[model samples]
Target chain A: MRHTKIFVGVGLLLLLAATAWGSDTDGVTQETSFWIGGHLIDTSDYYKKVGEYRSFEEDVWPEFGLTYKSTTPNSRFFFKGHYFDRDEMFGMISTKVSDIFTGKFRYNSFQRQTGQDLLENIEAREWLPSVPKGGGKILTHDITDPDADYNYNRKEILSEFSALLSRENNLRLTVAHRAIIKEGTEQLISNSHCFSCHLESKSAKVEDRTHDFQAGLDTKAGNLDVGYKFGYRHYESTTPTPMAYYEDAKHPVKGTSGAEFGSRLNYDGSSMPIDAKPKIEKTSHKARIKGAAGKGQFASSFALSKATNKLTDLSAKSWAGVFNYAVPISPKTRLVAKASATSITADDPYIDVNTFREGKPSAVDFDYIRYSVLDRTTADFTAQIFHRLNPKTTLSFLAGYNRVAREDYPVAGDGTTSSTIIGQAKVRYRQGMKLTTSFKYRFEKTSDPFVSGKGLFEVPGDALEPVHYGYDAATGDSLWGYFYYMREDLWYQAITTEPTDYHEVNLSSTFRPSAKTTLNLKVKGVIDKNGDLDSLDVKHSKLNGNLSFTFMPDLKWVLSGGVSYRMEKSRGPVAVALFDG
Target chain B: MFPFPAVRGDSTIGEIEHFGSLYTMADYETKAQNVYLSISGSPTAKLRLSSTLMYNKSTGEYDQVNMPDPSIEVSSTLVDQDFTFDDMHEYSNLDYSMIQVSLGLSYKLADGVTFTADGEYADLTDDAGYVYGIESGSLFMVRSGMKFDF
Candidate 1:
């Protein structure tokens, strides 16, 4: 293919050179140019295997295509053709319209065919149906064989009409519609050598329409600015397989058909499949904004939007918002921030719910409503300040505080509440280079009534009558006596401070060698001290580095590579749990 | 949750366990490659043509295994003398390939008026016949259409 394109280029260069060198002395020169070009490609078997015991087959048949494009500056057009075992076609046309309102109309047609295979000739080993070995491998279970092949024919005529009212003000509207008629399915017998007696064939019919409207507005937004566009599309497909003689060849076994395999055979057939209607649509809109920002500054911009969905299930909604802000932050600093956010939401009702009980009466009880032991709500606040110390240096500071509380419902008594305070600092240098250091001291205390483990009492039920009767030697003391010796007021005095205190320290650096790339090297150190536990000395540290690179030579292609390394070390107890009853 | 081999009791603490002799496991890994090309041309000064071709191939391996346990505990295995299993083992493989080609034409009558015509054909094949347990099938399709633009 590369060799062919090179040859074509050389031919075109020779033609242009001859035309320039062979010019007569006449003041007027008249010449006509003609050009033709095309390409063809083919590939074969490719495969990949896994797990030492299994194998796979991958193959692509030889297929070829070609195109011819011609142009004469003011006028342009082209002709195209393609060839494959399953399809073949040829067509062409051209036109030019720029001086005034212009339009075009054309007609095209083609035929499409499809075929299926013999299920019996296919193997069914581990599970499913199986064919007899060698000579008698015919399928008998299915009274009507699946489609072996079908053909579809399409014929369409299109026209586009548009007019430019004036040079400064122009409006153009385009509409295109297509019609297709597909033949119905038929039965066909295999070759004499094959055992299969017949196969089913079917066809499909399709109709579609597309529209594009564009309007140019030349107005002054202070100066002259132009903007315009619009689009629409629609499609429909139908398979009118009437309800006259529809019989399900298979029946449900354990569960519903297609849901379970154990009950797949239907001795008394009573099911069938139905055809569905097409539901696809789309719409689009666009606009442009361009003008001057301020003195000595210029600005130009564009905006576009498009959406698609099904009529039956119109649950998806998506949108994009973009803004470009360019202003001076200070006499020596210019700040430019471009931010865009896009979100999409879709709800699918087909999602299965495990709570459903088939064939059971639907009733609501207390068990149907789920409740939480405690309800809680928390609000947080955070802030960061960025300061420029010099042209190549900057400093930043961050502080945050949050308070959370868990209150038991149905009452408004003493509840558990926690509060914390955090602070950090950072410094950064020129492009892709920076040094960051931070220190955090958090004061967290929980306010709740405390009870000592030594002061507790237990009452025995009828099931534990033996223990109450003093038959269990493990608890020699009577319940009344044990309760008398318990201490229940260890925390009754005035409390000086809440309970937990913690501190953390961290330092790191980030570097970028070039645009579309980033690298980072950092070390984090932590020390956690708690007042609630006797041995509360815990420390954790980690050294980590990461590299990322993205290569987009042009908009058409992209390549990306990345890697990361981390080393973690710790010298402290991770967690400890205590339970008392 | 059918016959899940469970034991029920009302006591505060209770436990139940079961063991089986046959073990079944399966795994598969696959990779694929695809390529697409298209071209367009014009036969008449107001007519145009376009063509496209695409090919894709995917290959993978599958493995299945079943074996009796070499370790045992107090729980009894569910294998009986009359219940005989052959421990069937078969190598499974699959190959899928598809190719599509289309030719289209467009005619321009004026600055805002035009006509278009297109024909498309596609074929797909899965080589699953070599294995004892697999399905081998192939598909072929062709379609053509025309549209009026205004």
Candidate 2:
């Protein structure tokens, strides 16, 4: 509620200031302008109704917006704000102080409402038991009595500042900070021994705060351009604690309860721990250098950085470096190269937490792990050449190579490395200045295939052995739900390795048939193969086109239409594992 | 895996296990198509009108990757015949779509003055998802304002 007021107050202040900043400048001899607007709005209801996933929730009762700018010989200021019916708001304020410094502050908040649809679905699940342990069948379902609301809200604020450090105002230092707060609910499910298993959801409150500070210096010293910068960023996040439970209570084994069957009804109400959500924080430091080389005809840059993260008693570190440069071979030709490498090392231990059942902690479950010792290093390189074939045509060629090596404490055996190489070519041509066409072709291949055999590596922890179930008299004609279990000491029972190849083609074109008519088209396709075997072969293709016509040449009146077609064909069926038989 | 303590002297040891292969290579296919048209015109420098028309349709057979099969993922309400596998066919005819329309207008108050009014109307339609026959919220909007400079 406090944050809500702050956001609304800031938004309203910005709007009023932008609309009310008139020409009465108290003899400051400055130029000023202001614009204000208001709107009448209504939604399908007091809340927004979304058609599908990833759709926007449009809502509001009324809205207003305004913008204002004040300028003088030494300084300038500007403000803008917009508030919608849903109470969603946005604000931006910027100012320039003489030739010394410049700064800007921004605030934005978006809202989504889903309680109506969510409740509808929850109430419709009559097949599931209405209340836990109430009976063998569902009779009634309700979560409101337990205090839960399905309203999501997101708000973010960012501020940045930069100061001029030289008389020429070419050297500057900058810093910025941003805070993002998000609240939402997520539905969770489990693939139990049965098809339909756990149906639950958790509502969490999460917030992330990040701060960036950078200082750089740039100057021109006789035919040479040099610049250096150092930046540091620290980020932290507080995530929601998971609260898993049945959306609507259900019979343990879907009716059929007797001594012949499982004797007792052992229901698991919730398993989420009090501190289920880890408090995560990461900080990184980076430095960069850029300069003009080869008599100012080539540009070059280098960078290096490191990062660290801590969660409880575990932590991780990473190091990275980059080098880039570009040079012109001729008036119409240029070559650019870039290279980078990164290495991350982490050492963590396992953890044991108690599992909750029937609204209380029943016993300890050593079936969890925090993290394992992991170290990986990767390097990549790319080279590109651009050439002008003619006054209206251009061509480019690019080649890239990448490799990775890793070791996992849990499965650190043989074949812990992978590598790939790629090559691509592109062409662009303009015909009669009315149509422009571009095409790109790329090929990729993996080398030195990595193979991991199926086996268990001896490690330190708790585990169960591979289990076998069979039916016997007095045991009923049935199979035990437990198929196999890993010994706490070993993981990765089976592994496989292989090489792969990938090829893709892309084409796009734009045409302006007349001053008021335009057309665009694009086609793309990709083929993926696994070595020489038919290991999950895949084919993908897409086609898109757009045509637009403006009745008036001034663009005051316009119309547009677009369509896209996409298809993915996989020869090997990945089979259904979630729901279907 | 169940880790409960058991007294081996039980009368009967009835077991519970899942049936049918988890995944299979089947003839699965999905198809979708969409078409839309839009037009806008300004009769005068101060008045404008625009509207949009859209239609979308999707169908699937033996395939429901996007059909909101919340069954296997959430509850068992969508299935009619328990685990008889007959319930799987409930999703065979996974087809749904809608025709949406939006109309908007804007008008200026006077010449040389930066003042305008804006409004829009949207027609809410029903859905075929689990929330069957439930119509989305309709929307109406209008706004007016002016600008000044000195």
Candidate 3:
């Protein structure tokens, strides 16, 4: 088999070499174009800024991906693949605020709210927190204050696959599949989930997978050319039951009672007090439809293109479209205008991984909630104009507005149908070949009912027990505990965003200091302030610089190095309670 | 603060637990792809079977080392790092390889059930690392089932 493969490889290589040698630059000749490329990414701190216990740690590493393409003027095919593996150990310092959807509680003792403190210090250190008896009772924990030292460490593996195809008439198709599998949580277990001594005796594992596919086609009929595309994406996941020590006389102290306890609870083959379950296998199916219909006119100094687009939801058969036109008005002026309406409807299930890690009741099952299909219709229009002020200077301006009407079917809670209006304006300029700058501002206003799934703050509560009080055998006392269900306010609220703006300026130049090579230097800095109707102060700033030595152009190979520093912060007003106190 | 607390469900609701004497979960075996093979039993043939122990730290809770068997009759504690216990506690052999010597006859029943009786000798060795023991058992598989075309 090895020899057979080698023979095939050599034969193919020879055939390709012969074909290249035999080709002639003659009329009506057949041509084959070959290309290969790939990209590299390194995320040093992913999801690290959130959560008390850091879930993952990392070291600077390298991952290699390869892509190949062979094509004629009208037909082509390609394949690509990538793999990444690593062992990470770190603590989760802060939880992503989004994880509150799982109904997990996280209240600090000293920060308890006015009416929600339910457990004493010693009573608060058990496996699971207690809740009020009534089904509709809403308890809040004080989390207005921040705690910074919490963290948890985890290990993981990530991988991906991709392929592409291009048929006659400029038609193209691409597909990709990606997956991440997490194994070994031993390091994080000590601080997160483990039975004291038994911690050394056990470990936990988790797994996940995703797939994405896309297709694009373009063809010309008479003077009208059309371009269309569609995409699909899906994700699936699973995790087994993770156990800590069961309870016994020698092995006492249940749950995360702090790090000082000598022994953890032992299972001793008894029923688990908490309602622990594995990950709900959630699946998401996504489909997208996009297309452009237009005609193009080419000339020596300028070109113009105009088109109207139509898009539809295949599952629901509801659709809309926009009209767009781009024209080079003169040697120094160019303009583009676009307007369209879009509709969306779909059903997807989301998983709360934090619930599984904390061994709490998960909010991912069908019975917990079935998100009804959503129907939203949005209409927007934009116009952009650019001017070549001089041989070395250029300027561009942009303005746009959007309005959305959203409706939720089978509304479950406080969600409401409302409308929002959003608008933006921007300007960019380039001086000579060294300096480029841009400034933009955006604003939005909406009147809608908001439902915050997780807590922004809360006070801790009591230990969860069956209708009958359950006692810890070793302690010979009932387990009483409480943790705050962190929550943010949700109400019929009117909100606005103003001066959500940003500016970027970059300087670049290339100098041929030597005959053999030219060196290029570039530096850029940007400040971005963007947010939704709930808050207007989400912002970040970044400064970056790069120097490169281009050794070749035809072969397209360059050596470059760059570094970037960024700071991100968000500050919003306190959420006012909706219901009367 | 919100008016009513949201209700949540466990993600692992439909998962099956594998531990103790239970080799499979309810309704799980029905999905297995079934295959059948013919066998002959003879007195002169010799076979040997061996059993080994596997350590899975992540599969079960540490403090409760018994792997959470709600069906188990006794209380269970997590095996210490050394995996030692104060009492006569034992675990099932999840790792096993068998070789047997048989002196019997081959008889295939009309309804696809193959039944044969033969005297066989076998030995099993297990090292839970913390707990070491050597035990043996007979190999007997009575597979009686019907396959439908659909």
Candidate 4:
């Protein structure tokens, strides 16, 4: 709201000033433009998707623009404002002063419509009439506010300033700030199972904000340029967490055996907050240096950052170092090399869930420490060489290696590591100025790829045989054994869509038969597979093609057309557990 | 084995009779295409016209590959029913297409003055509706205004 007020006030001021000033006075020149218009929108059926990113309300709007330039001290100012509606608008202002200082400010606001899921497809029935719960029921949903419409308003403001601190040393100082705000209401849905397949939805208010600030200073020292930057970001949500009442777990139909059901649930028969957002703060510092080394140019940077969640008092810290160099081996050949390493450490928190079946005879403790997957160390190194075969042809080759080591992941007290080797080759040819073609091929081989630990399907040999239990004499119902024994021995491992081997190819061509006509074509393909999967042959492939043409046969007409197509396929495993017990 | 009536046992008869489930492979495929055309021209020194049309369509589906029958691992009488994996595909399937067209005209009414008008139309078709239902609709918007330069 503050940015909106500022935008309106500035627009009025600029309008008045431009009206009072002459078109040209002395060495000063000014241009001003204003427009007033109204737009109408008509929609049929569901309009949310049609007007997803726009305000569909029919309303009048105004636009204003001003540009002022002065030659005496070399200063220029530009401003533009478009007010479509209360929820949709854009404003921008940029200025240059004395060829030493530059500043820019921008504000934008838009509306987005969100959908509410009814969740009507979750239903189950018991076909056996002799069972305890003999009846069948359909899934039901309740909407607290059925007439409520879900939409959110997003607003963003960005401002940047740069100034020449020292002309002799070519030193510059820059500062920038950005803020984003989202405010609206959305539908919150929660479901409870085991007792009844019931879904409940309630309207929840959402008010979130994020702000970022950065400042940097750079200066030249002999043949090198050095710079340092500091950045801070904060995100907060002021909306109150929505509360839901969980149903007391029991038999779906008979509503008996409450204790058996209650033991399986961590919380029930009480109202608790759901989907609460956590406040976060992050800060980073970076230093970069660039200069000439021998007959080449080199640049290096070091950065460190830390982020914390204020709600939980948990924090993560990361540091990274990078180096890059480019040198010309000969007049027609050049080589570029880059290396980077990053390390991250995050606080591990202990989970304190209620002991499984707390007071029951079959109670078991299930609490454990939580290890973050974000705690990892990564390194990458790449070197590329470019050679010009002739005046019309150029070739480039690249080789790279990447390694990632995750700490206390998948299993506690053990770490998982993955490494990949990458190779690529590219060639470009130009036949005069009429046509240009380029082709690229890339290959990657990964070892010890990341896996999901215990989330995969078990091999037939590793799965424990089903246990048989006698029937219950009172109810005449069959007693079955639990599957935890089988689950504990499951030995197969599954990947999280990470490919162990992959190949990619891309080809593109541009043709300019004449100065007024041009054509472009591109094709890309990729295939990847993970052969180590025990029960699933994981494979993926993608293909894409694009073509475009532009023609300007005369000064009065210009035409352009383009088309693109893409296809992707993947084969993966989906495991479903049997919950008969 | 327990002899007491209603007494819980280490293993349930229901789980032992029906604890048969297997992981199956799913083939997921998606295809998308986009086309756009634009034409702009100045018929006269004081008049300019521009038009653009864009269309996009995408479709995705998931199919179970070599799904095994539950009866193969458990007694036929105990197996509740055969699951049709195809029925679950609708939850993840997608079929959507959208088209947008826009036209703009600008004419110099006088020195340092111009008139501009713009109109746009968009249509969306969601054939494979999921949780949000079918979001098929069409919208048209038109705006006209004047500009001045000094």
Worst 10 residues of 3 chain A by lDDT: A101-110
Tens digits of per-residue lDDT for model 2, A305-417 = 54455446456777788878788889999988888888876755565443322221222234455354347788899999999999889999999998877666335533256
Q: Give the TM-score of candidate 3.
A: 0.36
List lDDT for all candidates, in order: 0.36, 0.52, 0.32, 0.79
Query: Quick one: best lDDT, which candidate?
Result: 4
Cα error of candidate 4 at position B78, Å: 4.8
Look at candidate 2 and tell me the lDDT of residue A299. 48
DockQ of each: 0.04, 0.26, 0.01, 0.48
- Clash totals for all models, in order? 60, 12, 78, 7
Error of 1 at B107 (Å): 30
Which regions of candidate 3 are displaced past 4 Å? A1-202, A206-219, A224-324, A339-380, A404-564, A569-581, B1-150
Docking class of 2: acceptable
Q: Rank the candidates by lDDT, best first.
A: 4, 2, 1, 3
Error of 4 at A378 (Å): 0.4
Instruction: Compose the digit string of candidate 3's lDDT tens values, residues A1-581.
Output: 23323433443343344334433444322322221222122122212211112112233233333343333333232333332323322111111111111011111111101111111111122111132232222222222222222222232211111122333443333222222233222211211123322222222333333333334444443444554545444333335444443433221333333322212222333434232322322222333233333432321111111111111112332456656677777877887777777665444334222221122222212224445445666777777778877665566666766665555532544345444444555455555444445555444444442333343322111112212123457986654321122121211223332223545666666666444455665666555543443433434454555554533332223222222222222223232111101
Candidate 4 Cα errors over 4 Å, as ranges: A1-26, A59-73, A129-140, A458-491, A578-581, B1-17, B63-66, B71-78, B84-91
lDDT of 1 by residue, A180-287 (tens): 323334333322101222222233333332222233333344463545445444444444422212223221112233211112222112323324444545454545
**Who wins the DockQ comparison?**
4
> What is the Cα-based TM-score of model 1?
0.36
